[model samples]
Target chain A: MDDATLVALARSGDGDAFGQLVTRYRRAAFLVALSVIGRPEDAEDAAQEAFLVALERLDDCRRPSRFGGWLMTIVRNRSNNLVRREALRATEQIPFSARSSTPTPEKEAQLSELRDEIARALGELPEVQRQIVLLHDLEGWKHREIAQRLGLPAGTVRSHLHYARKSLRKLLKPGE
Target chain B: MVDNGSIPLELLDPGNSDPGHWARFQARVMALAGPELARRRATRPLTVGEVLASWWRLLVPASVVAAAAMASLLMPAETTPGAGIAIEEALVAGVDDEPLPAVLVADQVDEVAFLVAIEGGG
Candidate 1:
């Protein structure tokens, strides 16, 4: 069913309808949360909290068909709140599990530094640009889908991603 | 910017699939939402506990007011309101004259008043 119909049903206390909405948006929600929080567990927590809050305040959603964008706003707020409350208790480093086992200690050390630099760069980006970059580059989401979810123009999403990647490339340049 | 393929964006993605985690997460959200849904039902009556829980913020102040009221009612009237009669005596006479204590009458009054306010405002 469409999100608007599901939202109406959910507002009337339909658990199944809300559950379907959850299933449909869970990935996007998690990705958005992860973009802000930078940890899977924390992102999941924030996303789940967003869902509960959204369900409680479903009647406040003025545009029912735009549920995805509305929910993303909630997710972003929840994540940023979590960050503020926790004061970033967890490091925003992304794990480098794809590294080859045969690397020497010096090479491994360099790779670790590069990973940290990239994480710092991404973390420092504006929240919107960071989310667009992560969704586009990492999850392989189309600009159109990101635009729809984020309530942004497709061109704006592309521009943000381009700038974000450009910044990442400059920050990760070798022999710095 | 030179080729930066050496940096892996996928590493930061936190892979998009995790059925087990999502299931547990959905369950937690529903657990919270289930009671909220019930509490918000316009047609369904809220249980006493739910009502109290929902209005717990007002509980302490109301209780304090009630306690103060009872204390005031039960205390000996150093200065009677009129006819040199204590407030308790007047309430007792107004009722069935069954000699009910002034404190009980005040308690009943408080309960009725509270219920009315709740029904009126809810």
Candidate 2:
């Protein structure tokens, strides 16, 4: 079902409908939070908190059709708050076994290393670039969709994405 | 800008690699939000008809009392008991045939003389 239909059903207290919404937007929410907070664990926490907040303030959502954008805003705000609260903290290393569920230990280690490397590279980019790259490439959102949701011009989103990818490539391949 | 399909950015997304993780995340959110959703359902806004239906008991008696009061106010004053008697008394008093009696006039003079004596003493 579309976001509007799901939102209406959820408003009527359909737990399953809300669960579907959570499932649908969980990845995007996580990516958005990660872009802001720069930590997977904290990003997950922020996303979870954002979902609960959205549930509480669902009635205040004036436009049910644009639920994704509203939820993204909540995720971004919550992530930023988390960042501000822990400004002096150091970045925690991503645990290989904790985040990876590959069939083999060797593949798990490799995937974890790649994830960490990409995350580090992403961290070096500007916040908007991180958001645009993750939403566009990782989350597979169209450029126009990202522009509309982020309230930026389509050309700006494309420019940011181009620069973000270029930076990531350079950061990842400095030896080359 | 055409996206470079070669970046393998999907490696950074754990949700796709580990479905169980995302499942747990969704389950956790639903568990935490269940109570709030129930509250929303419980406190949903009532429709106009529902509001009227719920308040009919109080509204019915109040409407009856209001209607009775309006009817009483609109009724002609002649229907009331002693109303005609009061009008007749006023008309008779306006054009009475009797002259003042000597004893009653003497009583009035005595009251005025007593008040004047009290004021003089004070």
Which one is best on DockQ?
2
lDDT of 1 by residue, A48-87 (tens): 9999999888889999998988999999999989877776
TM-score against truth, every candidate: 0.56, 0.67
In terms of lDDT, model 2 sits at 0.81
**Candidate 2 lDDT tens digits, B4-106:** 4356677767665777988888888988998988987787777799888989978899999999999999998766566466754676686655533432376
What candidate 1 gets wrong by more than 4 Å, as runs, is: A88-118, A138-141, A170-176, B1-8, B13-19, B39-122
Candidate number with greatest TM-score: 2
Let me know the DockQ for model 2. 0.23
Q: In candidate 1, list every pair of residues with a backbone clash.
A: none
Task: Enumerate residue pairs that collide in model 2.
Answer: none
Q: For residue B94, give model 1's deviation from the true position in Å.
A: 93
Worst 10 residues of 2 chain A by lDDT: A93-102
TM-score of chain A, every prediction, order shown: 0.73, 0.87
